[model samples]
Target: MNKFILIAAVFLLTGCPGPMDPVPQEYPAQARLVDNKVCITVPARAGDKIFSVQFGTESGREIYKTFGQPDQQLPVVQGQCLPTFDFQFKPGERYAAYYKLTNPHTGPGKLFAARFSLEKSENGHLQLKQYSRSEY
Candidate 1:
């Protein structure tokens, strides 16, 4: 009886996880064209930090010079690291830009979206859509 009561007390002390609790899933890197900039969403473990985001050609040529400077440390809200920046490219022009998101401890994570383009809506507003992201 004492063992059963102790177990019950332990369970009560540690509350159960509610629906709002964050779950650990396959959190891959993502990208989207917002306004005149390309925004990338990179997710890491709770305590992990994203050092920098680098853009390169499809052939793996570094091209960070073409894009605007990124924020030193992107804001990680709701378990997502959002890093956004502008580039000097035409809207409809197809460019093979590959993104490399780096972490000091975890090496580097990559994402590539082919023919990256952002289209205008009928309302004349730029809409952000989920591009097909293949994690590398």
Candidate 2:
């Protein structure tokens, strides 16, 4: 009886194993400016989906200051899964694009931001250049 009690005490002290931490998943994306619009492309990943996108000239910190809300909230089509999405924007200007992605069975979601600018190419054509991207 004492041996059984000692074994029980050891087991309690060691503690039972708990659930392991989930591995972080990556959702790669790309953005570009075409004509007078900004195009964002996110390849389809297993169990990952983009639900919302926001565009603005402010930084991610500034946008988050406004409770993670931006002036231009792009519409996301429901029930339609597309790799590329385009929205109207002014050329020759710098802007930031925020994306909200989620795994249906996972927790809430994840937020990502990309900053880009337009520059004149050698051929006098406007070109889009992405500066930085962050996941939050």
Q: Which model scores highest in lDDT?
A: 2
Per-residue lDDT over 10-110 for candidate 1, one digit per residue giving the tens place of the 0 to 100 score = 87799767676744333445556545465655444443343444454344444452222345544344334254345444343334443343444554443
lDDT of 2 by residue, 9-114 (tens): 9977987554564644444456665453456665434565556655676432223222233333333343333333444444566777666766656676666556
Error of 2 at 128 (Å): 0.9
lDDT of each: 0.46, 0.56
For candidate 1, what is the lDDT?
0.46
Q: Which pairs of residues collide in candidate 1?
A: none
Give the least accurate 10-residue stretch of model 2, judged by summed lDDT.
59-68
TM-score of every candidate relative to the true structure: 0.40, 0.47
Error of 1 at 125 (Å): 1.0
lDDT of 2: 0.56
Model 2 C-alpha RMSD to native: 10.2
